[model samples]
Target: MKENILVIGGTGKTGRKVAHKLSKNGHLVRVGSRSGSPAFDWHKPEYWSLALQGMDKVYITFQPDLAVPGALNAIEALTKQAKNANIKKIVLLSGKGEREAELCEQVIIHSGIDYTIIRASWFNQNFSESFFLEPILEGFVALPQADIKVPYVDTEDISDVAVEALLNDKHNSKIYQLTGSRSLTFKEVINEISETTGRDIAFTPIAISAYTNMMKQQEVPDDFIWLVEYLFTEVLGNPNNSEITNDIEHVLGRKPKDISEYIKETAATGIWNS
Candidate 1:
């Protein structure tokens, strides 16, 4: 049955992909952005009621990381509103190893609504659509840590799982720990990009202070810097995160896209052309 679905961060990377797939599948999709019809803004409580109106299901993608201050409160308030609006199902896009994100998950779980939690590792799109894009274009990627290995899941896979959970009842009330089929260090990823694009890409491992200083020099926003530091120090530092998962195959009935494939496809987009 086709249902009206609200994608909270519909303009964002994964959310946009999910919305596209759902729309293509013939479901009613209302993008919930500040500029959208019945505009929705997480920081603006007054904007939510109109967005949630007549929506039976919602895909919640919290902006600026749920680890930030006031995220839990915002999520709680949104879930409450979703419940009162008679929204029957919710799918949350969450981060791995984020305590505050888990708190938000708790709110959804106890909201008496069918909820599916997609706790994902770092996104491969970080290299394509985020901070790493500039470095890749320049052929030199510099970062704070060298020893950590991240199981970076592709946003395409994330969107697939999210679409399944939202449009089907089979995935209700489950936490999907999604990751890439393999773990890759920063150097490994850079080397893969170099091979795929036939360019000399280099990974420079620098001190945390140096990385922070470089970001400040580049005029990176304070919130983005905080999120970067949190990911590097706290999330990446955890050894348990380096393992792969079968959740992608379990959900989509196929192996998740490999990093090389991601690199090749993204490289063809000419982002790394120099």
Candidate 2:
């Protein structure tokens, strides 16, 4: 059956991909962004009903990290609005090792609405599409938690699972943990990118405190800096986060994209060199 789906954070990493696939599958997709029709904004609760109105399902990716302050309240409020709008199912993109993100998941679980929780490891796109890209372009990368091995999942795989969950009832009330087939450290990631791009990129391991201090010196936002520190200390520091999971394969019936494939594809885009 064709469905009307609202994709919150629709232009974001996984959200845009999910929306595209849904549209290709012949679903009515209303992208939820500040600039999108009905104009969905996380900070604006009054406008949520406009976004949710007449949507059969919603794919939600919280702006910033769900670990940030007031996220739980915002999620709770959104769930309430979803219920009011008669939204049937919601697929939430959540962090795998984040305790606070888990709390936000609970709100959806008890919302009396059908839901699928995608608990994902760190994303492979961080090195290419996010903050790490700038440093890689500059030929130097410095970060905390360099010793931790992260089984970074690709956003494409994430979107695939999300689309499946949204379109099928079998995934209702399911919680899937998504990770790559293998784990890699910061140095390993940098090495692969450097090799793939044929660029001489350097990696430096620094203390978490020192790293946050550097962000402060750069005048990065305090809340963002706080969330980064929390992720380094809380999420990456947890050893269980490194365990490779077959959740993506289980859901999509194929192995998740390996980091090498991501590196190679990204290198071809000339993003790192640019």
Candidate 3:
């Protein structure tokens, strides 16, 4: 059945990809961004109704992260509005290691709407589109851990899964644990990208305190630094997330895109052509 789908955080990494895939497949896509028509701002509840208007399905990707303070309340409020608007289905992009994100998922589970939760691992695009990008470009990637391995899922893969969940009701009421087919340390990931691009990039593993000081020196906002620290100290320290999952293959019927492939494609796009 054809349905109207509104993509919240439509301009973000995964949300943009989800919106594009849905649009190309002929689903009616309404972008819910602060800049979109009938702008939607999660911080401003007034715009919620306008964004939910005329939509039967919603793909909700919270900005910053769902682990941030007050996310649960906002999610509860949004789910209520979705129910009020008669929206029958909802797909949420959540983090795998976040306990707070789990709270938000519970809100959707009991919302009486068809819900799909995509609890995703770290994104492969972090090296190209996020904090790690600049460090890679600078040839000096300083991070907190050298031995910790992560199952980093690509946003493209996540987007594909998200699109499937939204357009097909088969995934309704399912919680998918999405991860890359393999796990790699941050050093290993950087090495792979360096080999792909023929760039001599080096990974400098610093202490938690040292990394914090570096961020302070660069004048990164305190809250953002706190968030990163929380992720490294709390979430990354959790060992359960180190194992890879077949959820992507289970949903998309194929092996998830590998980090090497992602690096090659990103290099071809000139985004990492340093």
In TM-score terms, which candidate is top?
A: 2
Model 2 lDDT per residue over 57-145, tens place? 99999989899999999999999999999999999999998999999999999999999999999999998888888999999999888
Q: Write model 1 residue lDDT over 52-104, tens digit each, in one string.
A: 99999999999888888789999999998998899999999998887778999
Listed in order, each prediction's TM-score against the native is 0.97, 0.99, 0.97
Backbone clashes in each candidate structure, one number apiece?
0, 0, 0
Worst ten-residue run, lDDT, model 2? 127-136
lDDT (C-alpha, whole model) for all candidates: 0.90, 0.95, 0.91
Cα RMSDs, all models: 1.1, 0.6, 1.1
lDDT string for model 3 (1-274, tens) is 6679999999999999998988888889999999998899988997899889999999999978888887899999999999999998999999998888999999999989999999999999999999999988888898997789999999999999999999888999999999998889999999988888888999988899999989999999987887898788777888978978899999999999998888889989877775
Candidate 3 weakest lDDT stretch, 10 residues: 265-274
Query: What does the lDDT come to for candidate 3?
Result: 0.91
Query: Residue 198's C-alpha lDDT in candidate 2?
Result: 86
- Model 2 scores a TM of 0.99
Badly placed stretches (over 4 Å) of model 1 are none
In candidate 3, position 183 carries an lDDT of 89
